[model samples]
Target chain A: MIELHNVSKVYNSGGAPVVALRNVNLTIAEGEFVALMGPSGSGKSTLLTIIGGMNSPTAGRVIVDGIDVYSLSPERQADFRYEYVGFVFQQLQLLPYLTALENVLLALAIAPTPRTEKIARAYEILAQVGLKGKEHRLPSQLSGGEQGRVAVARALVNRAPILLADEPTGNLDRATGMQVLELLRDLNGAGQTVVMVTHDPQAAACARRVVHILDGQIVGDTVPAPEHALAPAVLPISQPAIEPCSNATERVQ
Target chain B: MVLLVVGLAIGVATAVALMAITEAMQADVAVKMDEYGANILVVPKANDLALSYGGITVGSAAYDVATLSMPDVERIGTIKNAANISVVAPKLLGAVPLMGRPVLLAGVRFADELRLKRWWRVEQGMEPSEAADALAGARLAQSLAIQPGDEVEVNGRRFRVVGVLAENGSQDDDILFVDLSAAQLALDKPDAVSLVEVAALCTACPVEEMVEQISHVLPQARVTALRQAVTLRMETVGQLGRFAVAVSAVVIAIGALVVLTTMLGAVAERRQEIGLFRALGFRQRHVGRIILTEAALVSAAGGALGYLAGMGAAVTLAPRVANVTARVPWDPVLAAAAVGCALVVGVLASLYPAAQAARVDPTVALRSS
Candidate 1:
């Protein structure tokens, strides 16, 4: 279980202090897929980063798997994150110089696995993400949705128990975004705890629970209806014309 | 990375070239000194003054008469650094009437004098090898209209002219050289030498120490080192070496400064990348190792190329610029030292930048983009 106790973040820009999060407290259970929903400047992304150990809260206690995450040294925290958590950003932060398969292999840089096994594992994860034949393509050569799949492959390559994705489908079209959402739902159904931050209700509708935040504090939390299921449509990014069935709460942007 | 490597290469090349040229200059100077003859001059402890009658020299007046004996020459061989004594030749001088004209004659140990004056050339015949044989200077031979195999009458005694020396443009061009014993017998001075020409090899010795030793053995004679010759060569070669060192230091400093600035800029530009690495579980040392390894690799390549370039510059430019044959020294130790120095400079200059990269805050850096 991941737990947060009175998490707060303050940023000093220029000279004035800006509060990004204020006394935001939340907990996530194991094997749970939760979506954090908020408007802009609502600290939803900050909350996700704090949980992922990417950012340190100004004042809070973060406990991961019963171990106090913030109490350990920065080095140990990095090790903990590598061992237990993986991250996917909206920007598709794949290194431009590396190929798709190389980007996925980057997650195993510190993994104590044999070189041949790591290569095989990276290939296997890429194939699972529906990027089977495009492993050698650079990020610039891949389409937007293919790049997103590469990012997903990198996050899942290490097989970390927790996946923190901030705006995973924010840059994709409705059909492509739905495919990504269905992929996340399938992973969550397979027992990977995933915490995602999104503004689209259709993406949140796919999660098991939704937490609402405003002005750096959680205002609402509820379990949503299981209205979205894995689409039977073969939503390969290469066949963009084959649109998958949409969720009930799909919002047009 | 290219800029860093080029800068380091320039520094290493300049340093190695300077070293090669300095070595060449020292070698050339040694050869020049050898050609200039012995560095130490020995003479009897007496002052000779020409007595004049009506502004014309009538006779010679000496305050004291002292001479170096053959035993004194043998004692000179027992100096502290006896092995450094390369040449020891004693001379007996006198004026004798030859062809009704008074000409000065010098008696020298043929072999020792030949070794001392390595630059001397006999234009006609070989060096004087027998007691009765004489070698005439160019001017003296020309004045007498002499030829090899002819006999020169000196003091009613005749000596065979074996060879005529080429014009050296010095006092040697105006005198005649004969066997030491023959000259001493002709001049009526038995077992007496006017002066000793001692060439003390000072390649690794203190010149004054050799002089002092010679003086201790022959206190009756005045021993003097040819300070003018020694000082002239030392000043020229030492000044050139010091200048080379100063220029090399400046070049190396510029190289190091360029490396530091380039590395700092690279780290600053790669903040997000470094933060990502940290986020991926790389510790501070691991990040530092990455940067240092890159620097060491570039520096080693620069060192090797610079060594070849330096040798090329030395062989092609030293002769024209320094007027010395630049012998390219194939020294592995020097090459290794140059490369090691470049590595040290490159890695040391990158330390602060690597540390700054390691200290990048993952949260801020990740959010910046």
Candidate 2:
């Protein structure tokens, strides 16, 4: 379980303090697929980074698996990040120089595992993500959707319980984005807790629950109907795309 | 990396070459100074008498009443510092009537004189080795119109000229040289020597101390030390050593500056890569180790190549510049020291740049694409 208590983040912009997150409190349980929906500059990505222990909240305590993430020393915090969380950065941030297999192996670079075992685990993860035959290809050689799968494989290779993804499909077309959304849904279905930030309602519908934020404040929390949930087949012609929320006062309940 | 290696190699090469050249030059100068002749002069003690007329002194006359003889010159060899003596040539001087004119005559042992005056060249025939043989100076032979193998009468004794010496720009160019016993007999002063020239090996031994030792053994003679010659040789060698050290220091500083500037630029370009490593849970020390290892490898290569190039250049240049016959040998101690110095410089120069790489923020991964 992941819990955030009154987490607030402030940035100094040319000597003036700007607040990115304001008194945000949330909780995510094991095996949950949660989507954070917000427009640009809405602090949705900030919340995800804070949860992953990559960003320090101005005032708050983040507890993951009964351990306070911020209370550890910097070195211990790095170890905690390695053992507990895996991050899929925005735009799928695959290192261009590394091959698909090598990119996946980066997650275990500091792991105490032997070299042979690390290679075997990296190979297994790449094959699981549908990149078995293209493990030696560079990112430039792979398609946009294939690169997204590489990022997902890098995150899942560590086998951490919590996966934090920020705008995973922001750079892909609708059809390719749907493929990545399906991959995330499958990973979450395999008992992995996922916290993803996105603005598209179609992407949000793939998650079981959605949290909406505007201006650094959470406005609503909702669970969609069963018919609105993503299915393996193409979307039905009768079910139209849901509109994005406009204000903090709007709620699905 | 290539630029760093080349810069460091050039610095090491210059230092090594300068040191080799300086040593060769000092050795060459010592040889030349040794050939210039004796640094100590021994002469008979003078007796002075004042000549006056009607209370007005015409002049003062000085003569050697007690002349230095063969026994006094032999006693000079038994001194405490006798081992430092390299050559001792005794000469008997007199004036003899020859061809209706009084000519200066100097009698010396040819073997001892030849060894002390290594720069002398015989222009015609060979040196005088027999008691009745004589060697004529360039000016004296020309003025008398004497040729080699010609018989000349000195003090009613006939002697054959066997050789004529080349012009040496010294007092030897105007005198006739003969065997010491023959000159002593012709001048009616047997076993008398006017002066002695002593060549002392002074590289490690002091000339003044040797002069004092010789004086104690030959009390009837005056011993003098040539201070100007010794001072000149020492000062020349000292100046060359100081010059080599100064140039080497400047080159090493330039090499270090090149490494620091190039490494700083490399660190700036690799910021995103370093951030990725940090995000992968690598410690700051690991990042620093990577950078330092690269510098050390490059410096080691530079040091080895520099040593070879420097030694080759020293062997070729020493002969032409320093005028030394002996070639400079490859020194193993110098080779090791060169490589060690280069490694130390490279690591110290890269320290700041490595620290900057270690300080890269891991949050850069989230910000940059």
lDDT of 2 by residue, B280-329 (tens): 56667777887899889888887777777777778898898776765575
Residue B64's lDDT in candidate 1: 59
Q: What is candidate 1's lDDT per residue for B334-360, written digit by digit as tens?
A: 689778888888888889988988788
For model 2, the superposed segments whose C-alpha errors exceed 4 Å read A16-18, A28-54, A65-67, A71-253, B30-36, B39-118, B123-136, B146-166, B177-227, B306-329
Question: Worst ten-residue run, lDDT, model 1 chain B?
Answer: B52-61
TM-score of chain A of each: 0.87, 0.88
Candidate 2 chain B, run of 10 with poorest lDDT: B52-61
Instruction: Place model 2 in a CAPRI quality band.
Output: acceptable
TM-scores, all candidates, are 0.80, 0.72
**What proportion of true contacts does candidate 1 retain?**
0.42
Each candidate: chain B TM-score: 0.86, 0.85
All models: lDDT?
Answer: 0.80, 0.80
Q: Compare the candidates by TM-score and give the number of the best one.
A: 1
Q: Write the per-residue lDDT of candidate 2 for residues A4-104, one digit (tens) a residue.
A: 99999999999999999999999888888888888889999889878887678999999999999889876777777788887777757688989999999
